[model samples]
Target chain A: SQTIHQWPATLVQPVGSPLSLECTVEGTSNPNLYWYRQAAGRGLQLLFYSVGIGQISSEVPQNLSASRPQDRQFILSSKKLLLSDSGFYLCAYERQGAPHEQFFGPGTRLTVL
Target chain B: QQQVKQSPQSLIVQKGGIPIINCAYENTAFDYFPWYQQFPGKGPALLIAIRPDVSEKKEGRFTISFNKSAKQFSLHIMDSQPGDSATYFCAASQITNFGNEKLTFGTGTRLTIIP
Candidate 1:
């Protein structure tokens, strides 16, 4: 069984506010999507990745941006948000040729006061 | 050189004692190596992986000791459990050119198994 969903589990924006984070995967199909960032103890940082539907690939370059708009959906955006942009935001998946098993989602705790 | 160096950021054992976490990497084209387990708000699981012709890899209580000419790698925890505490990550994989696969994380190791 596959399941991965992420949303406003926790968020408190401020300082130029504007950001959207959402990731969904119910039973898989296309797969291979990722966007990770964990700071506050620091480690995991990959920013963006996608392989189908509009395609997107970015690995650390700032303000944040990612969109797959359907085909399992995946979106992580920002029009303005900084204060280091806060922390803990992860969404991952893999299966397009395997890519060494990656499945995680259940995170999104951004607090940019 | 993608860099992946991790070690004793924090560790305290007691329940049966035996905790070791160490990682070292600097590209070398990185074949693949993974280890992750986080539990404090969640999201970071997949706690065993090794590939580089495999020097050692166990799956029960966790054990991975690989050294492809000292590119170094280690993670050992046996007889240890306080529910195994949390936070421990060490990853290195390179296969991107948009072909898929890319992960380089290691700046985490916060294991505490006191009971």
Candidate 2:
């Protein structure tokens, strides 16, 4: 069985501060990773997705960016956060050829002050 | 053209009652449709999914009714439980350019089961 892990279950940051969220998947190799954000009372919006290491495709251009540093490790970062950046961030993974089923991590709650 | 329109942003139902949620899409290229359930602060979990070729699929207490010609799909819950109270999201995806599939989600329907 494969498991996905996300760090800093909850975070509180002020505007202009930097942000970093990490996601790691175990028991899978060369999986497709994705980053999604959900605002209060809104559906999820895809932020970024990666096919392989050092390859990322952004769906919505924003202050946030994503990186695949390792095969199973993905990181979402921002040099300076904005008030609009506050939301629930999720990490998801799917097998390379199998894009139908996407498994999600617990998720990180970010609050910008 | 990439939107999946969902109706009844919120629904309230009594325990043991059946709750139905509907969604429609505009993109003909979309071949996969999935429904997710999310608790208050947890990530959305894959509840059920259906392909265009199938008209209906049932798993446990959940069922999905799909209409390919109408470009619409719906989720049905049988003998609903209070534990099923959560926000339901409907999403559609189509394989575009190099096996990369991007999903477009609906506005989400918040389902409340009153006990």
The candidate that wins on DockQ is 2
lDDT digits (tens) for residues B1-115 of candidate 1: 3389898889999998889999999788989899999999999998999998999999998999999998999999899989999999999988888788878889899999999
Candidate 2 residue-wise lDDT, B35-82, digit = tens:
999999888999999989999999999999999988999999999999
Question: Rounded to one decimal, what is candidate 1's iRMSD?
Answer: 8.5
Regions of candidate 2 where Cα sits further than 4 Å from its true position: none
Clashes of 1: 0
Q: Alpha carbon lDDT of residue A29, candidate 1?
A: 90
- Model 2's alpha-carbon lDDT is 0.92
RMSD in angstroms, candidate 1? 14.5
Candidate that would win on TM-score: 2
lDDT of 2 by residue, A1-113 (tens): 89999989999999999999999999989998999999866688889988889999988879999999999999999999999999999999988777788889999999999
Backbone clash pairs for candidate 1 read: none
Interface RMSD of each: 8.5, 1.2
Error of 1 at A66 (Å): 11
Stretch of 10 with least lDDT, candidate 1 chain B = B1-10
CA error at residue A27 for candidate 1, angstroms: 45
